[model samples]
Target: MIKFGLLWHKISLYASLLWHKISFCGIKFGLKLNISLLWKIWDYCNQATFNEVVYHQRTISSFLKVVFKEVDSNFAKLGTTNNSWFDYLILRRIGVETRAAPPPSMIEVHWWPPVGPWMKVNTDGSALGAPGSIAAGRVYRDHRGWVRGCFHFKRGLGFAFETELLAVIYVITIAHHKDWRHLWLEADLAYVVRLLNSHSLDIPWRFLASWKWTLRLLQDLRLQVSHIYREGNNVADLMVNRDCSEGWWPYALDEIKHAVALDMSTYSIIRIKY
Candidate 1:
């Protein structure tokens, strides 16, 4: 009797292992089917025994069977689905992988208008006292609608208004390089814009000395500076924030890199008129 009991125990262990193998096969088949691997699964199922098939159904086999049937039925109904078999497989794998994977790191990309005739310039500045760091950003867009380029500058700890003034200086320097005329410069800082348009450079005069040079440069090229709301200046703000980080300079003006990295399609480009 003891021998018989031992034999029964061994059989049970073997049965469990067999069941596990069959279940694994079924899961593999189901996953493949999601990716249009129906033929491969069909071939596998054909060679499987009734017991093995039944075992597969007992262990998450019902779930896989439902998935298989749903996918098969959908494919049959669609008749001419747009996706290729490889694409289907990749999408399915992505979905599964996404669920099992950690959340992806967020990447922020700024949008700037196109450059052409009669372009508008937008600029922004950021300063942090603790880090003693200051950064400025500027963007140029033409009337014909294309982003000419963006410029960013970082200086050691300075006043917030100083950073804003630096941004204007940077924009003027860019205009000089491109020989852009009839420019309309816009910034979110009201006081800075007022100071730029002010007749007398008051207490800010010391800081305004270098700005006089930039002002003379602007006068030589016929540039007009204006003040805009912060909300309207999001693009320049994005550039300034991103420039605060390391390694953002290389791809700063690369529209292609921005498009590819964001997974934006040609259609979006057309829609945005970029």
Candidate 2:
């Protein structure tokens, strides 16, 4: 008996929503008659069940398209003088309204010393079908101690060192796109950082090739690459973890990482070793 009652309630609610959409369409299109009757129907529709509302999604979408066409036609006929029609109907649809005026304003100010530019890159890698993983993050800060950017990468493949090199490649690609002239690259991977800085001889030739390629692109710009501690690169670390766990596309992951790097590089220059 209770289930039957619930079913009946759902049916009634669906009927009300349907009626409301019809009435709203009619009124909006300037079907000028019995406005009070339509208002009552509209009120009842607003009070209907949530499930009924979801069920009417298709109907509502169609109704909106029709109403938009009507509005466009009205605008064409009336020109800019018909602004009030849009203000009244669209605002009501979204339930926004202006009411009270604001009081006289009070001003507050805070200031800090300007920081210079630096680009921090962090990277991590995770291997497929294996528990082994490697990750790295770097921060580049300007002379003023403001962080320019952060980068993180994860490699689950056994090629942790190669993944580190890839992260640098990603960073350089971002720098090239943004037209950065001078950048300080920091990473937590000592061997990779030393390789980039030309201070180590034991690193792989592939990594050397990537570094050379990055340098070729940055030949017009001033570039410095350094090493920092893993803990100092937490933000990039988090980003890498999120990407790995969520299985984000390489393009999307690069986009987000590059955006962070660019924003940081443009604003502040602070570098910290983790």
Compared with the true structure, all predictions reach lDDT values of 0.54, 0.48
Q: Report the number of the highest-TM-score candidate.
A: 1
lDDT string for model 1 (90-154, tens) is 33532311112123454333333433456677788888874458887776666643556676778
lDDT of 2 by residue, 31-147 (tens): 442243356336435544333432344443444445434444544433221224433454345332312222345332211212245443444443443435655444333455444
* Candidate 2 residue runs with Cα over 4 Å from true position: 1-114, 123-156, 199-202, 205-209, 243-274
Backbone N/Cα/C clashes per model: 8, 33
Model 1, residue 135: what's the lDDT?
84
Clash count for candidate 1 is 8
Candidate 1 wrongly placed segments (more than 4 Å): 1-116, 130-132, 203-206, 243-274
Task: Report how far off residue 96 is in candidate 1 (Å).
Answer: 62
